[model samples]
Target chain A: MTTQQLYEQIQQKQSFLCIGLDTDMNRIPEHLLQTEDPIFEFNKAIIDATHDLAVSYKPNTAFYEAHGLKGWHSLEKTINYLNQKHPEVFTIADAKRGDIGNTSAMYAKAFLQDMSFDSVTVAPYMGKDSVSPFLAVKNKFTILLALTSNEGAFDFQTQQVGNEELYKKVIKTSQTWESSENLMYVVGATKAEFFKEIREITPHSFLLVPGVGAQGGSLQDVCKYGMNDKVGLLVNSSRGIIYASQGEDFAPAARAAAQKLQQQMAKLLHV
Target chain B: MTTQQLYEQIQQKQSFLCIGLDTDMNRIPEHLLQTEDPIFEFNKAIIDATHDLAVSYKPNTAFYEAHGLKGWHSLEKTINYLNQKHPEVFTIADAKRGDIGNTSAMYAKAFLQDMSFDSVTVAPYMGKDSVSPFLAVKNKFTILLALTSNEGAFDFQTQQVGNEELYKKVIKTSQTWESSENLMYVVGATKAEFFKEIREITPHSFLLVPGVGAQGGSLQDVCKYGMNDKVGLLVNSSRGIIYASQGEDFAPAARAAAQKLQQQMAKLLHV
Candidate 1:
């Protein structure tokens, strides 16, 4: 999906919420285990319940990959379901993947071409060639990791790089690469204060914020500092919404959590 | 495999060679594509031919992932084949993966527990929580990206971070994580001079060195600065060795390429 299209979706829904499908089989309702694919079934219901409230859905590949082939199949099914049912909603394959030039091209093909995700999160440690292949794919977004929500984000991301922070250099230098206009970034909601510094560098680019709800990032702080004219922010909530209630009413419960966030986002947007 | 077991294999074979199984189906011999599983077949032939010469085999996951589900199946078969036939040979899943705490644990389980790789390369962009779970696994290694070989490495890695370079900070910071002993690092061969600084911080840890032949880094230069008493380097050669020929002679050609590197490594080891 194009940036304009994503922005439009936010306007239409009054929410820039990106619900994370970090589904764990063990954490889901006990009844769902009887199904053919429990993970897919759970995701299907959640997507059905909260599709309108959330503008995007990000399925972190690690959750699926942990289950091996069966998990991968669930991921394939989940993305396929989303594309068929709600083409208007953006999809993100939050697989933090990046490699050498040729290898990265294969990754770009795997997530962006074969499975058809609108964006795939990429790590910038390998620099240009590793990330360029993903950016090279037309109409697809390469959401590069900047300041992640995890405790590990401080290890290197916030360190001084010449005059600016390392992540600032990441945002600045990546802009010069080919087709960088298609680029977006993953900036953790936990570091809401950093959003001011981040916006000074790339004011127009969209930021995928992942720390809200469970990770203790306030939605209001993120919007207060990170928002742009286009409402350029995708606030993601995973465990907080999806696992709100593990009973058979899991889907409706998820909708409730998402609706609360959507209401908050609407107020922030004055929609 | 433990670091000691890897050092022993290098000593027993008189080579610290890591042949990358970057097998591309389109690039393999035409005759092989007629088989039930061309990728697995190609990898089997290459591994069988060069098992004695090379101490480790690094199958870059990106190559297999690009092929989709069938590609993932091929990867499963390839790793299973390595574990069964050549149990002595160390395996590295060159999948540069990292994420949040729980998500990273799932990734650790995928590569280390389910797939049974001795090591998996991880990007350090996410920091301690992203890396700690990988280290938590018993006898497994987490090879963190330090100084990559690509031109993009200079983009963020070489930049100053307070008193040290970003890559240097990466090395130092990761050392304080949970199982620092289980940690190895990816210090690309192209930046051989950086090894002097890297070794100062990580004197005993194994370093997986890529970019020897195909990417144009001198084996001699890498060995001169990077080697410890254990010959702490797994110098990988992918295209220069794996895709040595496009005909039925591919297996033998791969063996010959691996053998040539083994000879140079043997000389370096004074064996």
Candidate 2:
């Protein structure tokens, strides 16, 4: 999906909410286990109920990968289902993958092309060659990890590279790469104040902001600093939205959690 | 497998050569595509031929993942086959996976615990929490990416963070994490001079050195600085060994290539 198309979806839905499909097998409702693919079933239900409220769905590959072959199969089904059912909704494969040049191309093919995700999250540790492959894939977005929400973000990301922090350096250096126009960034919403500096680096590129729900970042703070004129902020809420309830009404509950965030976003967007 | 067991195997085999199973379908022989599972079939042939020469097999996950479900299944079969048939040979799932704490735990479980790799490569961009979970896995090595072989390594890795380079800070900070004893690292053999500084920081920790054959790094230079008393280096050569012959003689040809590297390692060890 193009950035303009994504923005149109946000306007149409009056929301920039990206519901995270971090479907944990143990955390899902127990009755779903009786189904053929519990993970897929849960994901499908959540996507079905909440697709209208959210502009995008970010599925973390690690959650599915935890189950091995069956898990990978579930991931396959989830992506296929999304493409088939809700092609308009932006799909982000939150697979933090990066490697050497050739290997990185394989990963780009795996997630962006084969899996048919609109975008895939990439680690920037390996630098230009490792990440450029993903950018090379036309019409697909490479959401490079900049300032992660995790406590571990402080380890090296916040450290000084020269005069600036490493994440700032990452954002600045990434723009100089080939086809960097396809580049978006993963900036933690928890670091709302830093969003101002980040936006200054790349004013127009969309930022996939995580840490809005369970991880605890104020929506207003993120929007106040991070939101572009096009509302280029996909504030993701995973655990807080998906695991809202473990009862039979889990899907509706998921929708309710998502609705709450979407309502707040709608208000912010003045829609 | 324990670090001592890995060292013992290296001593017994007189080699620390890690054969990288970066099995690209396009690069593999045409005849193998006729087989039901060409990736697995090719991997089986290569493993059966050169298992004795190479102390470890580092299967880059990108190759399998590119094929989607079938690719994942091939990966599953390949790892299972290695565990069942060649248990003594140290296995490295060159997945380069690291996420937030919980997600990283899932990845650690996926590769180290469930997939049953002796070790799994992890990216350190996310920092301490993202990596410590991999270390928490008992008897499994978490090979952290310290300095990579690719040209992009100069982008952020070689950049000065404080008094030392970012890779050095990574190596230093990593040693302070919990279960740091199980932590090994990836230092590219391409930069052999950097190996001395890496070894200074991680004296006993095994370094999974890539960029040896296809990418061109001298074995002699790597050992001169990187090797410890236990011969702590798993020098990986992927394309040079695996793609030696794309004909029916591929297996034997792979064996020859591995034998050449093993012989060099043996000479280095004075075996």
Error of 2 at B127 (Å): 1.0
> How well does candidate 1 match the true structure in TM-score terms?
0.99
Every candidate's DockQ is 0.86, 0.92
Q: State the TM-score for model 2.
A: 0.99
Q: TM-score, chain B only, every model?
A: 0.99, 0.99
Scored by DockQ, the top model is 2
C-alpha RMSD in Å of predicted model 1 compared with the true structure = 1.1
Candidate 2 Cα deviation (angstroms), residue A120: 0.1
Give the range of the ten consecutive residues with the poorest summed lDDT in model 1 chain A.
A151-160
* Each prediction's whole-model lDDT (CA): 0.92, 0.93
Tens digits of per-residue lDDT for model 2 on B1-271? Answer: 8889998999898889999999999988998999999999999999999988988998999999999889999999999999999999999999999999999999999999898999999999999999988999888899999999999999999999988999999999999999999888999989999998888888999999999977889999999999899888899999999999999999999999999999999999973
Stretches of candidate 1 off by over 4 Å are none
Error of 2 at B252 (Å): 0.7
Find the candidate with the highest lDDT and give its number: 2
Clashing pairs in 2: none
